[model samples]
Target: MIDEQDEFDEFSEAGEAEMDENKGLYEHVNITVDPKQEPLRIDKFLQNFRQNSSRNKISQTCRAGNVVVNGQIVKQNYRVKPGDQISLLLAHPPRLNVIVPQDIPVNIVYEDDDLVVVDKEPGMVVHPGFGNWDKTLVNALAFHFEKNGSKSDLDRVGLVHRIDKDTSGLLVIAKNEYALSFLAKQFFERKTRRLYWAFVWGNMKEDEGTITGHIGRHPKNRMQMHTYTDGSQGKHAVTHYKVLERFKYMTWVECKLETGRTHQIRAHFKHIGHTLFNDERYEGHTPLRGVNLPKYKQFIKNVFDILPRHALHAHTLGFIHPTTKQDLYFESSMPHDMADAVKKWRNYLEN
Candidate 1:
């Protein structure tokens, strides 16, 4: 649930890495003047694309030499012409909390000058947020950097994408500005590939299918996402899924994200009547499928105890290297708890 947030809050999350144009801040934007673009003031041109951005903020950034056009810092009134490469590095909003280094253990898969790849375990929040102040993945990354004497101003330690606290999986962390910008672009453009493995409550009839809906904050419940099937509201989101295996009343599936909307896979599946197994937030813990006998109910409870959290895992992540331009792929096996629950279901089927 990395991208699950209010629409306005999304801008607060940093995506840009270090670029020659921007002073290496979290707020960065890159735009190329179109061939048919008429000569317009730089600030006005940016305002057209950035509706929430204010002219005063744009002016301040231009004056601070954070607006680069054709490799040169330009004033707010500079005329943007066709074929111009424009980059903006806006100031980061005020920090709410001071990030302190904590000696938390993390499973680092790969590390280099530009970035670090990690295989995150279940129950570890990726970054500090409301009710999650310490012992997060960012705290561990901070400690790792402090121990190595690597000083940086990057916020959230350059996390490009994140999984939910209960979801276990792989993540890529940028160590430098260039890598962050490069990876963020790939994610924003939907070029990176992410695969998740999940066990849902009901047996899916289709071998494979795509779920299309607009995902946004629930009107009544602010914590959850509401899927708009009519394309009337919310941002566009798509999830593609294929059935991998089936139990008596549950199914295992592989999910590929076409768009990284918050709670997209969970919400989209629920829209089609297949809530993820053990997903307490979406009422997946209820006996939505299977027999109504007391023994069957007890078995479901036992399985829930075995897998307390939702039965979902970020199985694999693939992206193009920021520096090398080569394809990079990472995979993590299912966590023990989820695998054990699957085994339990298999045993029940045999019996």
Candidate 2:
């Protein structure tokens, strides 16, 4: 999850259709410079925003006219200005998905003839798409199915819903058409329960609250999401949250998603000005709270190093069984990175 990682990696999965083909080159990133953004060179700006991207690669792309600002090509040294519309095109076209099977391991918590429940680890892509084509959860499932010699009513497996690449948590996959239709309906009808744990910036104005908005792709940046509350854009989404704990500089909360949208929790928290901690795409990585004294600044840096990705996890999932008609719920323990960070925060607070 790089620059657009929250909503960037957060796509409206759950069977959202792929965008039209680029024919040859693909538009990988588009951005709308925030109104308050300070002047910076375009190359440096991109290098900072896109994780793991090298300056030489960015410079080379700029030299090849792959970087565009407001529909005009710009050089690496071109200073980015406020409200600038920037788009980056990858030189190569997207490879078609044959969905090659891989032997990647997945944590299958529950499995039946109808469905499988998996506790997906962080950094695993759910399906084959975009930069990830193979070595996905889907690929692993295919291998598992083939090895077990299981037959399904549907032509292929189905992912009931989707989580971001870097978001660790529970996911249900349909093994047959009946399971697919039944489980998919629950998600669409808002009958399923999806709960997330997130560490966000700032103390809340209240103990708990609901967030409502329409979420859609950012106009200037296709990888990120923007919320419109006037019912003017995207699909309606709702999230209910309650405070579980509070740190000196951050708040710990449990979020129940009433409706699933791409990056629903992350975008909603951002809309309310409590962006997820260490979320690079949403400006949460800049030490947004507390004085940057040597001791405190070092503390922030240590935690960031502990948990490199955004501080969000799909902690719990509940839904009625499609085949048995039994209600089922599963909760995952907090990942080590997050748990360790919380421990450090607790010690810091006590000291």
Candidate 3:
């Protein structure tokens, strides 16, 4: 029987071997589909495992005999059966430029030997990517850890979960491999607690409710995500939201995520006809604009100008400490812009 230490050693060796092979990214995961796992297309199944693999790339691999099911090449639409053996021969993705550590400042809300909880500011990308290749929270953490002789590699050092780039609030970073693995398991098992605050368009009729749907990439637009009803390709996502305050047109809401999908809160709210304020993609045009009241229209325009991104903040985070096994909770107040929006709306209502 393979013990935990042995398993870790094996993983380490495999990673080293892949590095030797000049593959920038490689992972071999073996999982048995649970009985609850609904039937999914083969390409979709493979896409879930490879985070950076595009759907087109997945399909091309399927056609090129890189994907095998039960030791035989299969089409993309092949239904994934439980207990079936699946193997993928994926080429390594192009290497990203080496990310140099930077001295970007971060708000450390709580810290211990095992982990650090940070109140990340809005407009700060968590990690390096695209146009945001430097001056990120990861770069700051790397610099800080280096000072203590605890630096980690590029793929992941302390990060376990991620909040959207524009979302402000509390986030946790693991200090070691044990903590990283434990926290990752918590996320996979849906055991962690995440809550958000958002100012959404329109007054909600219900005080509290849940939004359930399957989320996947937009069929035509590769950049955006959309709800899938045909079960063709998507993961089940759920969000529970309650109206905290209501104004003439907008509403302040507190949302809890039952399933954490990319853009889950933003997408789910939009799915329910209440796109978040300043959400350019989901809520394209401002309803309050062109109204007779010039003051209200100007207020709406100001809100948009001040906040250029989605009006969402990850206000609360609760999870078990990876190494200590102690329950940890962290919360952050809404950032200046969101607080200002709420204040102005309240003042408008009074007047």
Best by TM-score: 1
| Cα lDDT tens digits for candidate 2, 1-351 | 223311122243333322211112222567889888899999999888865555665665676556779889898899988899997753322233565667999999998898888998878877777566677888887788778876742224366677777788888887765565456546644678778899998878789999999888878877567889998888788889999999857999999877666678778999999999998877789786556444887888999999998898889889988768899999999989999999999998787
Candidate 1: residue 12 Cα off by (Å): 12
Q: Model 3, residue 224: what's the lDDT?
A: 52
TM-score of every model versus the real structure: 0.77, 0.71, 0.71
**Arranged by TM-score, best first:** 1, 3, 2
Root-mean-square deviation (CA) per prediction: 8.0, 17.9, 12.3
| Candidate 3 per-residue lDDT over residues 235-287, each given as its tens digit | 77778988898986888899987776657777777777888888775653475
Clashing pairs in 1: 17-181, 18-177
lDDT of 1 by residue, 1-351 (tens): 011112222321222111111112246567778889999998898887677766665665565456788788788899989889887654432233777889999998888777888988888877766667778888898899888877544463376666777778888887754566567556655678789999998879999999999987678876567789988877798899999999858999999987777677788888899999988877898876547544788888899998998888889888888668889999999889989988988888787
> lDDT per model, in order?
0.74, 0.74, 0.68
Candidate 1 has what TM-score? 0.77
Better of 2 and 3 by TM-score: 3
State the weakest 10-residue window (summed lDDT) of model 1: 15-24
Q: In model 2, what is the error at residue 225, expressed in angstroms?
A: 0.9
